[model samples]
Target: MPSDSDPRTDTTVVAAPTPVSAERILEAAHRLGLRYFVDDEGDVGIPWRCVVVHVIFQDTRAVQLRGTWHRIADTEHLAALRSLVEDWNATRIGPKAFLTVGDGGIVRLHGEITYPLDAGMTDAQIDDFVFTGCRLIVALVREAEEVFPDSLRGSLEP
Candidate 1:
């Protein structure tokens, strides 16, 4: 088949998949016991971080799994970062939490936080948030090393 409007009338054009983002890496890390916070209302009343960790299984055996340790981050950039992570998790790492060794054990993890200086947000507050958030992420990553398989440890290691 051939068409003037179609650039690749005979050839198939395939687009590459999107890459993962620091947020998703952080999210997965959170599931493995990481935490962070995102300012929602701009009120900044008290420090808020969502922590949800559970264990599920592929069977009815009720086998427990590692929990997530996620903290909060700036709400403005949440959407963009989340999109990046989802893409990375899907394309790069497939749809598995724990990668098997023989199955090309490679995972892409981008641990980052975007805290742009807002005209309204105070510097001291931002500093506090970053300090707390960084500590939480670092601690969780360190602890996860013991639990996560050697092959599946670290940020984006093959």
Candidate 2:
């Protein structure tokens, strides 16, 4: 009914629906056959099946995906974890790898991916992003396993 053209007519105007939303994003990711849940903060995360993949709202215009690979047992474990981070960052684009060492020789490995809103992310794009995150997670887990024989976090299975 000529929604935006010459408002002189008495026809009803229909508002265009928002193409994407946080709920939609999570739904799209779940469609990839992965289980996801929303946190109290309204952000989304996939921690049901494997390592925690924290999907947080960076701003009104962007969303960030992050997950820690593993927490190290002691300072001696730092070397291999850091090497894995270094190698991953060198070879990958987004989802950069990281290692953190805390008091008492505690150490950990992490990963992240940030996507800014453009025209708006499509459902397929959402699925692809989740899949990519999963792939990165698998690689990091494999590295963690290699670092310490007992560093098995979780299996990347259905």
Candidate 3:
């Protein structure tokens, strides 16, 4: 039973379940196979290459993911990595990289996935964020290895 004015009257439509609270978001994180630490305030911290995401709780119904890469402490290494990151950002396909050169001459690079989850996210939607973020991290680590052949030496650490 559908009315002519109903948007779903012409095609099959299934609404996505929204993930709004800390518990549901944590569940989605588990489904993504990622180890997450949720604090008393309902913030989420999950590991990523070079960066860590602090999924800050907004209202009871929303959150925002912010990631900051680890800083390279050596001045020479920092400069070298910055050059490499700049080159890769110009060529590689993914979210645009953001960076900072802070005190102690450290260089840090970070990237964010553009998942529109204002209301929250479905499990599938959460997967989109997790998968895309991991891929981008891999790409960055590969490019960084090329920049510091000796320092980067082996694969990403556990």
Candidate 4:
């Protein structure tokens, strides 16, 4: 017979899931020792050098980590940039990567990863998501630098 104190007889206590919020995301970033700032619109953002990752809370019960690369590419490199974005989207389990062409045909790179939080998450999960999201987007930017050596304008350094 198994006693109450037996290892197999111990009751398991489950903690409630933590609801996702911008505050929770910021708290996780803080615990990771990352520097963050609130935008003029009150959104929380983490800057990785020239890349800024925004922690966005959605009304649909989701949290998104969106990052924008600071470098702008000339339209002359559009084909190569498109190929890179396509290959990344096709081969990677993202942080989906893409390019945005602005006025005067200038191109910019961006990446984003979203997590559904309808059922909520644990503190560990939130921290992991924040860290992973930031790292993945930064990786995308680095890969772009490798693909186009001197084409991207602006410094990636702080």
Best by the lDDT measure: 4
Query: Which lDDT tens digits does candidate 3 get at residues 25-47?
Result: 57767887887787786577777
lDDT of each: 0.34, 0.67, 0.61, 0.84
Query: Candidate 2 — what's its lDDT?
Result: 0.67
Worst 10 residues of 2 by lDDT: 149-158
| Residues 12-73 of candidate 2: C-alpha lDDT, one tens digit per residue | 66534344567877786768877788888787778633368887675667776788754445
Better of 1 and 4 by lDDT: 4
- The all-Cα superposition gives candidate 1 an RMSD in Å to the true structure of 21.4
Question: Which candidate, 2 or 4, would have the higher TM-score against the true structure?
Answer: 4
- Candidate 2 is scored at a TM of 0.71
Candidate 4: C-alpha RMSD to true structure equals 5.4
Worst 10-residue lDDT window, candidate 3: 149-158
Comparing 1 with 2 on TM-score, the higher-scoring candidate is 2
Query: TM-score: which is higher, 1 or 4?
Result: 4
Error of 1 at 153 (Å): 8.1
Worst 10 residues of 4 by lDDT: 149-158
